[model samples]
Structure formats: C-alpha cells, structure tokens
Target: MIKVEQLSFSFPQKELYTNISFTLEEGQHCAFIGTSGSGKSTLIDILMDPDRYLFDGRLEMEPGCSIGYVSQFAQPDTSADTTVFEYIGASFIKLQNEIESICSEMETSSDIEPLLDKYQLALDAFDAMGGNDFESNIHKQLNLANLMKRRDLKVSDLSGGEFKLVQVMKEMLNRPDLMIMDEPDVFLDFDNLNALKQLINSHKGILLVVTHNRYLLNHCFNKIIHLENMEIQEYDGRYIEYNFSLLQTKIELQELTLAEKEEIERNENIIDNLRAIATYNSEASRGRALKARVKFQERLEARRIKAPFVDIKQPEIHFGIDHDVQDLTVLKVDQYRAAYDELLLDKVSFEMKSTDKVALIGPNGTGKTTLLRDIANNHPDSITLHADAKVAYLSQLQGEVLKDSNTLLEEFIDAGMSTYDEIRAHLAGYGFEREILNQRIESLSGGEKNLLQLAKVAVSNADLLLLDEPTSHLDTYTQIALDQAIQDYKGAILMISHDFYSVVNGMDYVLIIDDKTVRRMTIKKFKKMIYARHFDKDYLELEQQKKALETKIELALKATDFELAQSLMDELEALIKLL
Candidate 1:
C-alpha cells in the first residue's frame, strides 16, 4: 500500500535519516522502533503528509488509497458533545447522509445524470466501508476493548487513556487502506494494553505502529522497522525472532572483531621491533617487513566490526543518593481523601519505610496521580514526611515539573546547583546534545521530556523519590536502564506505574488502590494477578523455564558450540509451546 525508497531528511539542528527505505504491504503490521529522540514520530509525520516537508525520497501510495492517523498525544475534543458510538460511526453516517441527500435532489433536479453519478459514488464508498454492518462492528470493537458500557458516554467525558482506545476503534472501523498510530499505547493500563494488542492483531489492513511497550512489541507486529544510526533496517519477521537474529550476528561479529584486534596488536608490536632493528642494522629486508606489517595492521583496522545494530548507545541513567534517611518511616499517609468531579479516593492510607521500594497501581483515572501529588505536597492531615527526608518528584505530566518556555539549559540551571558547562555535561549523559541546549522544552518529543525529568531526578540527591509512570514514554533500552536504576537506588521510592515488568521485577511490593482505599499486595501475588489476567494458566511457569533455557543458549552460543546451542534451542521450542 505504501513504499518509501532512499528517504533522507534533516532539520537545521540535526540530520534524522539518511537513505532510509521501507515498504508496507497489505496485512503487514509494522512496528516502528527507535531510541528516544530518533525521529520515529517525525518520520510518521512525513509519511502522513509528504507535501508538508521538502526532502529527498520516493514516497508512494497507491491511487485511491486512504490513510488513517492517530497522533502520539491525541485527545478527544472537550467542546464537542459527540457520543462514543456516534464518533466511531461518523464516517459511515456521513456517506449514508450524502447518498440520501443525492436521492432527494434527484426527486426534483433537472440535472439527473450528475445526481445519479454522485449517488453511485457515495454508495460505493459506503459499501467499501462495510456500512451495512457498521453499527455491529462498532459494538464489537467496543466490546473487545471492554468499553461497551461507555458507548453512550460523551467523548469529552472519557479519560485520556479511554479516549485513546476510542480513537483506535474509530479509525479501525473506518477501514482505511493504511493506519498509522504513533505511541498509541502510552498511558494505557494493563487491560487497555491487552485490548490494544488484540486490536492490532485483528486489524486486516496495513498497520504501522510506533510503540515501545515490550508486551505490544512481542505480540503485535509481524514486521520491524528499526531506525538507528541515521539509517533504517527492515525485518520481515516477528520482533522476537528478529531480535535473536541480531543478537546472534552481533555475537559472531564481536568474536571476529576481537580476533582482529589481537592480530593488530601483535602486528603493531612486531612492526615496532622490525623498525627498531632496521634502524640499528640498516637492513632493506627489515624495512620491507616493517612496511608489510604496517599494511596488515591498517587492513585489520579498516575491516574491524562496527555493529551499529548491536552497539546502539543507551542513555546512562543513575539515581544517586548522597545520604540515606535514618528515619524508620520515610513517608506515611492516613485517612487520605481526594476528589475531582467525584470522590475518587477516600480513607486511603499507605506508608513507606526508609529504603523501601513500592509501586502505587490501579486502573486509569483512579486518583493515583492525586495521591502521589498529595504525598509530594506533604498534606498535613493525611500525608507525612519524615523530618530527615528530602523528597524529589518526577511527574507524569512533564509540563507540571518543567517550564515549557525555558530552554533545556535554563531549566537545569534554575536548580542553582550546577554551572552552565557542568549542566551541559550532565545533560549529555542523559542523551541531550549541546546544540539543542537552547531548544525550548516544548519542542522535545515525549520520550525526551521524560528523559530530562529522569536526569533531573538523578541529581536531586534526595532520599525519597516519587515517580509517576516513569516508563510511559521511555524507549525499551532506557526503560531497562531505569529498571536497573530503581533496583539499585538506596532511597525509598513510591512509584505509580502500569508497566507490569517494572512492577514485578523492581518493586518490593505493590500498594494497590482498591475500592477507594489502599491495600498492600506481595510481589508474588502481583505476578500471579498479571499472569492470570493476561496469559494462559501455565504461561508463567513456562516463561520462567524459557528464560532459563535462553540464558543457556546464549552461553552455548558464546562458546561457539552450535551443537549445544541447538540442543538448548530445542528445549526452548518445547517450553514455548507450553506458553
């Protein structure tokens, strides 16, 4: 349906892509992935409206094909009073109305030929869109998303995450030739994420999705378009299989590179010795041997492996604590009550001791953000902070903690702890370039802003950290880095997250907001809860075995023993069947 060949694009400050090429065929679900600030979203913009930008490329879409788009920050129009069902069926309704109007005009018009032609066009469009069963299709999508009860709800009344799902259903039901969704999984809860997976899997048309959610990456896409090192690579296979292929190739190339390095070093030593002997003996043969060794060394250096795919640079993220809180209780909340349009949280209580790591989790719009804010603000009646505790917060709404008008440099300098040069160096570690130091915070991608927030939190030296959905916009590599940072952090942390891997792996326990109150659940129970809801009954056990077998396979591959590797792969295949 769509093809891009040798596409190259750049901005004044940075060159994003150089000769990137890919294709989207019917029934292929493509996952567009890249590191934060790698211009995946920008590429989507180019695809959606090629005329808006001047670039070098051949971008072609078959004639008469239609495109559907969902932006990264799509929100329902609050001023509109459209119901969810009406919104989803808007396209079908419009065509139906046009056909009816044309028929009415035919009843009295003198130019009957044009009216008949218009009627035929409208009918064709409606039939192509499945208008005969549009309502049933809408209900089916809503039911699959578990939003049937909210079909009559105003689009303006839905939560942000719910509205995102509604947007997906609206676009999918329209049955456009190609659908492009940019980070549509952001801010969605566990159930919604699963629902999104189903929607992507069931989509029949061509799909190009920009996402970083591991679950979706594993389950949704059949093709991978990876943007890295100012280039693009396409893999016509599952992401898991593509990833394994990359790993295997990287391992082999690394071994070859290591051998080349040893040869170069040995040649260098021999060359030095030969030159020294030639200088002493004035021998022509010695000089010629030295020249030969030099050439060999140069050749080895030229052919050395540069594995961009495997050697992708990851942001260095470390949450450092200068000192530990001596207080037994770092924070405590009792009888906490908060409300917006209605009472969302009532009599909610929770506490965290020093060095404790806990996750605050609940459904979307369940006052998780409100409770985190109250704790950060130190509400006198219900929330308490120890006298010895110094707290730092990373808000889900990046704008709340950062000024849109300020430049990246100015924002960091406002902290009064680092000089201009020092701040620039620190931001570099978090993957910000010096050229964009004066760039406004508002211009950054969502992942970049979240990364900046993480950089700030890293330097706070606070003994208590409050993080809300820290992994929402981060790329997978950065997310894994954050998981490690959270695991290694010495301070007490109360984080609000819907990412199941982060919760089950990094957190000590979970503080679940249930029935407008707070309760604690062990990590084991939390794992069980997720496995039961999202996987087969035996999936958890089989997944564990698979991971172990994968580790053994990696070890065998590292030893360059294909026999052992194949044996482990067989075991893994059997375990995967159970999963």
Candidate 2:
C-alpha cells in the first residue's frame, strides 16, 4: 500500500507534474497508460526514489513493506557463478535460515518461546506463498520468457529474452509485498506473454505494471491510471473504462473549444470598439480601452488550447510502370522445412499475387519468420518484378542495420536516395527532428531506428512491402498514422505482426500457420474461426473445467495434501493433453 499527496516535479525546460495525488491499495493491480514522453517513467522513478529529480511530495508507504522492481532493460548477472536453479532456490534458503534461527533461540531460552511461536508460522507462510510450486513456476516462467532451453546454460550465453525472464523470475522469488514492472513485455513473444498473464493472475501481492502491449493490458489490468498533459487521472475499472473515459474527455474538449471561440470573438469586438474610439481622437478613453483589450488578449492566449487532430498525410505512391505481370506470381514457396530437432514448418507451399495483401498470423514460435525468409529467398526469380515493383523489407531486427558507421542522414542518402531535404522532411514526419537526423545511426532508440527504417522504405517507392512487427515499439497514435499510410499505398504487402488491431483492420487476407503447416483463408473466415475457437459454448465448457482443476490443485497444496496435489496435477496434465 502506498499513497502520494500534493506531488509536483519539473525540469528546466518542462514541468512534468503538478499537485498530483493518488493511492495504490494493497493487492491491487494497476496499469499506467499514456502517450510517450508523458512522464509515466518519471513517476515510477519518483516512487522508487532512484534519483533526486525536482519534486515535492509526501509519500506514505506501509511500514516494513518490501518492494521488488524490474526495469525495462534489466540485464542478467553474467559474472555470477550460479545456475538458474541456485538463483531461484536462494529465496527458500533464506526463509529456511530465518525459521531455523528462531527455533534455535527458542530452545536456548524459555523467555523466547512466544516469539519463537510467532516465527514458527514461517513454514505455513512459505507454503501458502507458493513454496511447493516454486520449481514448476520457475520452469513455466522461464519457458514463457524463452529461457527454458538455456536454463542449464550460463547467464552470459543467454539472449535478451532469457535475461528478461531471469529478471522477472528473480523478482517473483523475492516474494515482496509489492511488485513494480516496467515494460515487462518488451522482448517477449506471444507464448511468454500468455505465461506472464497467468503468473500475474495467480499472484497474490500488489502489482504495478507499465507496458504498451495492448493484449497484456486488456487481459490482466483491472485499474488504469492515465497520465496526460502533466496530470494523473484514475479510471475505476479496466481497459474498457479507460478507453471510454478518453472518449468522454475528447467530447468535453470539443465543447471547451466552442466556448473559447465565443470568448475570442467577444474580445475581438471589444478591441474593435477601442480602435473606433482611437479614430475619433479620444486619446485617454482609447488608451484605457486599448489596455483592457491587450490584457484580455493575453489572457485568452494563455489558456491551454488543444490542437485539432489531423491525420497523417500519406504521400502519393506511384509504383513505376515497368511491365504487365498479370500472369506472373509475385511470390511462391514449396517444400519449405526448418527446425531444430523438430520441424517448425513442414513442406509449406503458397503463392502470392501482385495485388495480395496477406497477413501471417499464429502463436509465437510457430515459425512465422522462418516462413517469410524462405519465401523471400525462393522468390529470387520473382525479384525482377513488375518494373514498378521495388521491394522494401522491414524486419523485427531492423536495428541490426543501424550498426553501420554512418549518420542517420548519411544512411538515408546512401540507400539510393538523392536529396537531403527530402530525407530530413520524411524523418521529421516520423518524429525525428533536424537535430536527431544528423546523429549516428547507432545512437538512436529502438523506436527511432524503426521509424527511420520505415521512412527509408516508404521513400523507396516500393510496390511490395515486407513488414515484420513494424509497430512493436510504436505508440497507438503513431500506429494509426502508419495504418493510414499502408492503406493508401498503391502496392501489395506481406506483413507479420503481433498488433491484432492493425492486423485485423489493415489486412485483407489471412495466412494461419500451425503445426508446421500453412493455411490461407479470407479475413472474414479467419475471424469466424477465432471466434469459434475462443468464444464458442464447447470452448467455454472446456475452459471452466480447466479452471476448476486448477482451483482443486491449489486447495490440495494449501492443505499439505501432497498425494492429492500430485493426483490433481496428473489429471490436469491429462486434460491439457486432450485440449
């Protein structure tokens, strides 16, 4: 439990917050949602007391409460000579030591028996804290974080995703009263995202999470704290409530705009009357009226006015007319197989038309990227496409391209472009200002680098676009702009993305990958399948049975019924197999 009152913080150039107040109750799960650069991270740092930013606030925290924090870019302890098991098992060791020390003291002195009795509660507390399921939980989370395969490997050899998983596991092992996670879903795939959701849902402690993943936010959060315009506002309900509240705010803003317009007109009339008096040679009266007019004009200008939202302007794309390829297939793949001990894609075959806008969709690790690479490689003959068919690829790992030793502007010009002004203008459209345009490519953030790549691809006048997770680090507003740009492009597209809203709204065809096979379907048909699989009566019944079984297992463990726990676990495993 934590409470803040009259919080204020400011920087030299901008004020981030003023007179903010909020309370986070024990065992509450709250999400901080807002636009980029809106001070969400700043508030988190203030709460954690990491660095002394300019601030004036009274924070009342629960006495003796411990807080565990996981940052967005947490790196694994590579220098430590410890296994994953040893690291996670350390928590149990500490708990055991405390319990033993209390018992020893009680045995040595009769005066300590009452205190010893209080300490004796540790074992039950530990058990209730998921001590029995600790190993399973660690394994589950590691697998979800894409660290399971490397569990036996040293931390130094683990990938970014593995390091993130380890950090999450470490926070969970501490069993703190409150957990604060910033961008926990940054490097996670869909499987890990689901695992994280399940972990959070089952967790008993309070959680404050900051993430831009809509899927995670929609599924896990019950309360939303929206930070905007240097103010904090709370929504009593979940994601839906936050969204509806935003809509209401927009309506209120419209009404406010109308009232301000009327006020502006009134002020203009007063200024006109003052001018007429000045023309009639009434110097004293005119001067007094002019002063009044000037004061009113200043007040009107000082009022914070919201700029009217205008959609991003998409440039007219003309895929140069080279040749009529009505009969030529734009893409073709056959007998593609890739795997590490298991086939991820087995003998997949598909063809793409010049006009096809296909979306690749599946659960994580189902070989979406592998399939794309295979298609891109096998279609070399199709490369010399329609004279106007220039191809531009946007991969998830586009940051790798930024490793080149060139300034951002230099790279844009070197990529077959001619004009510096054109490059600067396009980069600015993607939120990069002139100062950033001259910076080295390696100095940019992931989001900025992504935007640069998109700008380059867009300017190439490519007729065929290949995008893989293009919207990962982008905010919702930017995503909408990108969607509009893609919609207006007079070219075909093959994209692999996890953003469901964009995929559903922009795609015309769906290609579902599952169990090493590919099935092409219309978007309408794919939607029907998803609806039936997730929301049908039979699926609901199955889900209810699964929940009941999970509850039974939890009760068995809490009761110290190991045999029952094992039985229930076995039954649950069988039920999962059936599903």
Candidate 3:
C-alpha cells in the first residue's frame, strides 16, 4: 500500500501540484492522465526517490515492500555488452555471488563445520528471494511476447520496442510488490500490447501507471487520476465511465441554478439603490452613511458564483486549401515492395480515392514507416498520383520530415504564415507558449516535434496527407485536437497510428498488416475481424504453429540450454517462412 497526503511538487519555474492526496492499495490499477508536462513524470520521480527533493507532502510506502519502475522511453544498458538473459539476471547477481562464495568456502574448509551452516543459510536466503526461478520467469515473458529469438541479441542492438519489452520483462520477473509503468503502450502493436495487458492482469500487485493509450485506460485500469488546469480529479470508475461522469460535471459547473440566478439579481438591485443614494445625496454629515452603503453593496456585488475553470482552447487546425479534386482518384499502388537494408514490405497493394480517410497499422518494428516514406519520396512503381495532386507528409520520426536545426519560429515562418504573433497564435493550439517559439526543433520533446509537424501540415495546401504515427507521443487533449483537425480536413488522408481512439474516430478505412498479409477494408469490418478471429485456414495454421513453437522455445530457454534455444529459433524461422 502507498499513501500520499497533501502532496505538492515544484520545479525551478513551475509548481506542478498543490495539496493532492490519494491512497493506492494492492491489486488496484490506477492511472494518471493529463496533458504533456502535467507532472506525471515528476510525481513518479518523487515516488521513486522520496527524499530526493523538498516538497510539502507525506508519501508513505509500505516498509520492506519492493517496487518495480519502468519509465517512458527507458532504455536498456547499451554501454554494457550483455544479452537479454544476462540483463534480466543482473539484479540477482548479488545473491548468486553470495551463494557461490559460501559453497566455495564449504568445499575448501578443513573443519567444514561453520562453513556448512553458512552455506545452508545462504542457500535458504537465495531460495526465499526466488533466485532459483528468476530466469524461468524471464523466459516465460519472452516466449509470450514471441521474442525468444532476441534472448541472444545484444542490448545495444535492440529496437526501441524490443528494449521496452526487455526492461518490462525484467521488472516483472523481479516480482516487485508494486509495478509503476509510464506510457507502456506508446509504440506497441496488437500482439505485444496484448502480452503487456495479460502480464498486468495476472500480476496480483498494486499498479500505479500513467499512459495515454485509451484501450489500456478503458480495459486495464479501474481508477483514474486526472490532472488538468492545476487541479486533481479522482474518478472511481474506469476510463469510459470517468469520461461520462466528467461530462456531467462540466455541464453542472457551466450551468447556473435558478436560486443562484435570483440571488445575483437581488444583489444587483441592492447595488443599484446604494449607488443612487451615493450619487444624489451629497450632505456633509450623511455623506459617510451613503459611502458605507455603496461600499457594502459593492462587496455584495463582487460576491457572485465563481465560475469553474475552463480548459485552454483546442488548436484550430486549418488543414490545406479547400480545393476539391475533380478526378477523385488520388493515389494507386500495385504490387509495392519497399526495402531499406532489408525487405520491409513485400507485394503490398492499396489505393486511395480523393475523399478517402485510411489508416495503415502494424507492429512497431514493421514497415509502416517505410511504406509511408516510399510514398512520400515518390517511388516509381509504388505510388500513382493524379496530375493535380499535392502531397504533404508528416513523419513522427524527428528529422525525417523536418530539419532539427531550425527553430520553431523559423519553421512556422517557412509555412508561409504572416507574422510572429500570428505564428504564436497558430502554435498555441498545439500547447506551444510564447517562450517555446524561439526554441530549436532539436530541443523539443518527441511529442512537441510531432505537434509542430501537425501545425505545419495544418496550413499547407496539400491535397493528400501521409502521416506516420502522428499521435504516438501526444497527450490526450492534443490528440483530441488533432482528431478534430483530421475530421475537418477536406483532402484525402492516409495515416499510420497506434492510437486506437484516433484510428477509430478519425479513420474511415483501415489497412491491417498482420503476418505479412495486408487487408484494406472498412474500419467496422476490421474491428469485427479483430474481435472475432474467424480467420481462414492459412492464418489459423500459421497462428497454431507460432504458438506451438513459442511454447517449445519457452521450455528450452527455461532450462538455460543455449544449444536447444538456438535449435528452436532455427525451427521457428523455418516455420515462419512456410507461412
């Protein structure tokens, strides 16, 4: 159990929290949702190190209990040359070393009397801490994630998603009493996301997580802690339920009651009478009486119902010129093959009409970004655009679609906007303040850079927009803003995003890339296919083979036999090729 009382936090220039309180008990999954830089990370930092900074708060963590923390964009130890297996065992090194030392002493000692007791005690301690089954837990998670092949791969060679999985697996294998994860669903595909969800659900521990993934919020968590406008709002239900209640509360806060309206009217009448007396009656002795009456009425007049805080306005994105395409057929692709050092996509074909709103979705390490880049770079055989089509691309991978050396102000100016004030006004919709105008593109966080690209796209005169993971790092409010912009867009849009909410709400068509099969259909049909996996014989057979291979690889790795693990990998690869 963890208890936070009257918690207040501060940085060099900002006060993040003021008098916030909450209690998180075991077996409860509570999430923190807010806009970017709303102090979710800072609160996690405070929890990780209670005495690291000065704050007016009492954070009581249960004594002797362990904690596991997986921060956002948390990387593995790349400098240290180690495999996934070795990295997972890094935490248990001390116990293993102690056990080895005790056994060595017992074997060498002549008397062997004292050494025997020491060895027994050390073994008991190691066993009590679950040191014997540490690798077993790791292998289980790795197999479930279908990452058993990555066990022998070096930490430095891991992709971002792979590194995140390894770090999470280590934390889970540690068996901490509490697990705190930040943005765990940032770049996950369906399979890995399901693995993470299953892991969280199976863990019988307290979970205090912070994420913007709506699926996780709606399905995984039962409680929500929302920080907005410098206020903390606690909801007793899950994400959907909390949203419903939040709408009702906002309506109540905005509307005035009949009694309150009448009270305001009465006060206005009193103020009018008092002002009349003060203005007309100008006698010397009675002047003080009139002044007092006016002052009292003024006070009463000032006292009215204080309006609730309103959120900052969502960014108004005017995406592209309102030029409708007469020909209608915006783009066409036939038998597309994209490759960068390795084959990313093979034999994939798709098309887009002038009014189409499509989403291309796949796993993190797949060729979604590669396909977008090929289309943007105007590959000969891949893209067939109309003569009048104007193409604009937004890549979440920084420096791909933008020059990082340029300042935000410079970028906005290059977008053909008028003046500095106008630029700030435009950027403000994406949560940019005046201070950030002069900041360079490289200095911004991933989320901010993505938003800057969005702002640029908003003002462009493109008839087609190809976006890759546009909402990966944005907060909830900014995502909603972008969704609205996409809805209002006149041109055809083809985007690649892992955000379920954005994909469901903003996209009319979906292109699902799974197991090398590309399926483009209505979002409604794809959703049905996802929920009810009544796939064809080929897909079902491939899935069954993959599961069986994963199980076999899991058992082999649990025994820590490298030869067997490698053999299973060879077989798994052969089986994948057959698919």
- Quick one: best TM-score, which candidate? 1
Poorly placed runs, candidate 2 (over 4 Å): 3-22, 37-64, 70-90, 93-170, 186-192, 229-231, 304-328, 339-343, 371-388, 403-411, 416-420, 434-445, 532-579
Q: Which stretch of 10 consecutive residues in model 2 shows the poorest summed lDDT?
A: 308-317
Model 3 agreement with the true structure over 1-579: per-residue lDDT tens digits: 788889887766566888888878867888888777567877888888888979997999878778899977786666888988888777676778887887787777899988888778877877876888877777777887778898888987777777787788788777788788988877777666766776666666788888877556656888888876556777776765565454334334334443456666776676577557767776764666656666765665566445322333455656866665654788887788767766767778788888789999887766887778878885677678887888888986668777888888888787788898898888887668866677778867566677788888887789999988788767766776787789888789989886655776678899988666478778777666655632233543454575466557657645655567567666766655554
Tens digits of lDDT, candidate 2, 409-509: 89987886788887777666666665657767775545556667777777666657788777766555556567667766656788887565566667888
Question: Each model's TM-score?
Answer: 0.92, 0.71, 0.79
Please identify which of the two predictions, 2 or 3, would achieve the higher lDDT against the true structure: 3
Residues 1-579, candidate 1: write the lDDT tens digits.
689999999999889999889899989999999898889988988988888998898999988778899887887899999999999899888888888888888999998997888888888889977999999999899989899999999999998888999999999998889999999998898888888888888899999999999788878889999998888889998877776667556556766776788888888899888878887787777778888889888888888888777776678899888864565988888898988889999988778899899999888889999888877774668888888788889998898888989999999888665688898888888888767899999989899999999998988998889999999889888987898899888889999998877887689999988899889999989888998788767554565576567668768866877667776666765655554
Pick out the ten consecutive residues of candidate 1 with the lowest summed lDDT: 538-547
Each prediction's total of clashing residue pairs, residues at least 3 apart in sequence or on different chains, is 0, 0, 0
Q: Candidate 1, overall lDDT?
A: 0.86
lDDT for 22 (candidate 3): 81
lDDT of 1 at 223: 97
Relative to the true structure, candidate 3 has a C-alpha RMSD (angstroms) of 13.6
Model 1 misplaced regions, further than 4 Å? 107-113, 281-289, 325-327, 378-380, 538-579
